[model samples]
Target: MIRIALKMLVGDRPKYIGMILGVMFSSFVITQQSSIFTGIMTRTFGFINDSPLPDVWVMDPKVQYIDDIKPLQDTQLLRVRGVDGVEWATPLYKGLLKARLSNGVFQNCNVIGLDDASLVGGPGNMIKGKLEDLRRADGVIVDIVGAQGRLAKILPDGSRQTLDIGDTLELNDRRAIVVGIASISRTFQSQPVIYTTYSRAMNFAPRERKLLSFVLVKAKPGVAISDLARNIQSQTGLKAVTAEEFKHMTVMYFLKYTGIPINFGIGVLLGFLVGTAIVGQIFHNFTLDNLRYFGALKAMGASNGTLLRMIIVQAIVVGLIGYGIGVGAASMFYHVSKKSELAFRMPAELLIVSATAVTVICVIAAIFSIRKVFKLEPAIVFKS
Candidate 1:
């Protein structure tokens, strides 16, 4: 019965193609938009995601997210380090600074300061030059995305090229050299990033009474990160959270405080509505056009249940094919744009949600067709 239903569906080449295309368009829009939303949300916690060495993050109690930098007093670092179950703790300086490019252009950049001895909180990967080169006077690491944007240079070929190892810029009237290029996750703001020692970062950034932005701490062996974080928060009177907890906190903060979630939700809802409208109308019309054949089968002793099953099988085939094409296209888009500034990540949860949405569309479309067919009179075939 299923095979016969599939053959019947395929026999009408035009309607078959239209049905698939409708579902395909719907799935593409929903999947792509959802993936982009997830990607942006992930970037909200890029600092914690990139730095895996820190088990606990200590920050000001008022700080809601990573970008909400409420600078802590330098003495806070010592306080966090003195907490029991803390293997070690280091100061991390994070601030926004304006850089005077070699071309005399000024651009805002994100500056991060890692510990001098351990280089904790530094970039995870370096594309050029050694990480240790950041130890040199006025030396700093520039992220690849930043280099390609604010630090790009125009070539004779009329193309822009990212800054190289020897590129130099000015920060706070001080000469800053790009000693290395680091490959880090692109931030939501897409700002250029610079990394240097805590002391150098302090010199480059505009002077402030409190320079320490965060305290990155690692828990001792056999110590639970949550327990250590609680201990630090109690002892130092600062807000402390495990790395995973902080990431979740940052994501939740953006979702609740920003309009991003609402916007994405609207997009997905529109996709669902559009898909249902297109597929539902077409499938209903298709069933009506085949009413004479359906009446003939019923008159010949085919049960209504058997006819309904055939319709469902046909809908399932169309849904599967259309969904496969849409998802494959979205995946390919992510793969191709991974290196570009446009962030698109198709997480497993997104794929599952997309599949469920497509399934709902198909079921609804089938239900409409089933209703029309179930009302038909078998004797109507003879009249026709």
Candidate 2:
């Protein structure tokens, strides 16, 4: 029965090809759009991942996303340190600073200022010079990848020059030097990052100290981070979360409060439904056009179950082929976008789930076509 069904499905090349294309088109649209959406969400929290602070992050209770500026006070920092089980607490300033490149073009850089000595919130990875260079009153560190484009100087030869170690640059009109270039994975937000001392950031940056964005806390040994975070929140009236919890919070904020995930989800859902409906309709029509053959089989005492199996087999074949094309096309787009300045990445789990969803939609769609075949009267073909 299986062999006969397989032969019948494979024999009709033209009809099945239409079904395949429909399925593939739907799957491809959903996968590519979803990947782009995921990339944007990752960018929203790039700063959280870039920081070299404690396992827990303390933020203002009112802050939702990292971009929301809510700097803590000196008193708040002391309160956080007073919490039990805290090894050390430091005030890290996060703010936007505008600097004039050597080319005289103004660029806004995400200024992450670390506390002196503790250096809690600075970029941990530096390529050209030591991280401690940020301790200088007029020193700053920039990401090598980031500095290459926005901050780099174009020399008289029309060639790009790296912000060399010990090079001087302006941060808010202050005398700031590029003491080091950080070597780290490209950050989200697609903005260049520069690290400076907390004091310099407070004095030179535009935003004031009441806006200290975060207080970083390191836990002493044998103390659970969650417990310490809870104490900090209670004492300081601030929100504290583990790094993982903070990531989840960001993900949830985007998924729930923002329109990004919802918009992408709508696209994916529409694609899935439209694809399934079109494929189902086409498969059903194919079965209807070939109703006489099915009727003949039924007249010869072929069971409804056998006919149903044939329809399902045809459906699965179309679904598999369409899914492959869609996923393949999406992969190509990802590769192209990744090489550019875009943040395009597709996790393995998302791929797996998306493929499974396409397969399910195809299978469900085939059921409609199979029902029509099962209902056909075997005697009808003879009459016609």
Candidate 3:
């Protein structure tokens, strides 16, 4: 019975292909859009992800996210250190500073000032030069992406040159030498990242009363990280959260306050609707055309239950084929786009979601066909 049903479905080349393409289109759009959205949201907390050494991040109560600079007073650092269960606390200065390129062009840079003593919250990977090189006079480390991009020097001939060690940039008119090059995650702002010591960053920053941006803390051995974070907030009247908690907070803030989610959501919804329309209409028409055959089977003692199973089998075959092709294409697209600035991440969980969407679309398309088959009349075959 199943073999006969599949032969009936495959005998019509155009309709078979159409049904597959419908589901494929939906799977592709849903997978592609969702991956891009997830990648972008992940970048919002790129700084926290890169600074893996710090277990807790302490900031001003009003600071909503990493980019929100509600600068804390310099004394806030000492206050956080005074909390019990803290192995150590280090001050970090994060702010935008204007840089005067060697070519005389002015560009803004995301300046990260690590603790002068501990150098906590520095770049996780160094492509060239040592992390200790920041100790050199007027030294700064530039991220590799920025070095090859915005921070790169432009030639008089209209070409650009990648920044390298021993290159110099002027920040706030203070000379900053490129003593190291580090690999850092690209931030949400997409600004060139510059790493310098806390005290040096203070000089580069325009004079402000509160120079401290955050306090990076390490918990004592065997201490509970979450509990220590809570203690820090209570003792200092500041906001403190574990690293993972801070990351979740940042991603959630963007989701709630930004239009990013809505934009991608519309794309997925359109894909589902368009797929349903195409597959539902064509599959129904195909079933109507084949009604005489179903009627003949009924006349020959085939029950409605058997006819129902046959329709489901046909739907499953088309659904699986379409889904496999669509997801394969999406994965290929991601690999090609990775070489460029495109942000795309498709995890296993995302694949499962895409599969579920395809399954639902296929089920919706089959519902109409199933109804027609169940109502088929055995006498109709004799008339035709």
Best by TM-score: 3
Estimate the TM-score for candidate 3.
0.97
lDDT per model, in order? 0.89, 0.80, 0.92
Candidate 1 residue lDDT tens string, 1-384: 778788889998888999898889888889999999998998888878888999999999999989999999999999888899999999999988998887677889899999998999889899999889999888999998888887787666767888999888899899999899999887776789999999998898787899999999999999989989989988888999988888898999999999999999999899889989999888888888888888888888888999999999989998999899889888888888877777687988898999899999999999988887899899898893
Show where candidate 1 strays beyond 4 Å: 153-161
Clashing pairs in 3: none
Model 1 reaches what TM-score against the true structure? 0.95
Instruction: Supply candidate 3's per-residue lDDT for 340.
Output: 75
- C-alpha RMSD values across all candidates: 1.8, 2.4, 1.3
In lDDT terms, which candidate is top? 3
Q: Give the per-residue lDDT digits (tens) of candidate 3, residues 1-384.
A: 999999999998899999999988889989999999888888899999999998999999988889999998999999998999999999999999999998898999999999988889999799999889999999999999889999999989989999999999999999999999999877798889999999999999999999899999999999999999989988899999999999998998999999999999999899889988988888898899889998999899999899988889989998899889989888999988987777788989999999999999889888999888887778887793
* Per-residue accuracy of model 2 over 1-384 as CA lDDT, tens digit each: 777766776678877788888888888888887787777777667667776568778888988777777766767888888889999888788777788887777888888878977787666666878888777669888888767887888898989887777777788788788889986555545668888887788877775548577888889999999998888888878999988788778878778887887888899888888888888788878888778888888999889988887777777777888889988989998877776766666788778877887877877777777777778878797795
Residue 378 miss distance in model 3 (angstroms): 2.4
Which 10 consecutive positions of candidate 3 have the poorest summed lDDT?
375-384
| Candidate 2 deviant stretches above 4 angstroms | 156-162, 183-188, 207-211
lDDT, candidate 1, residue 78?
90
| CA lDDT for candidate 2 | 0.80
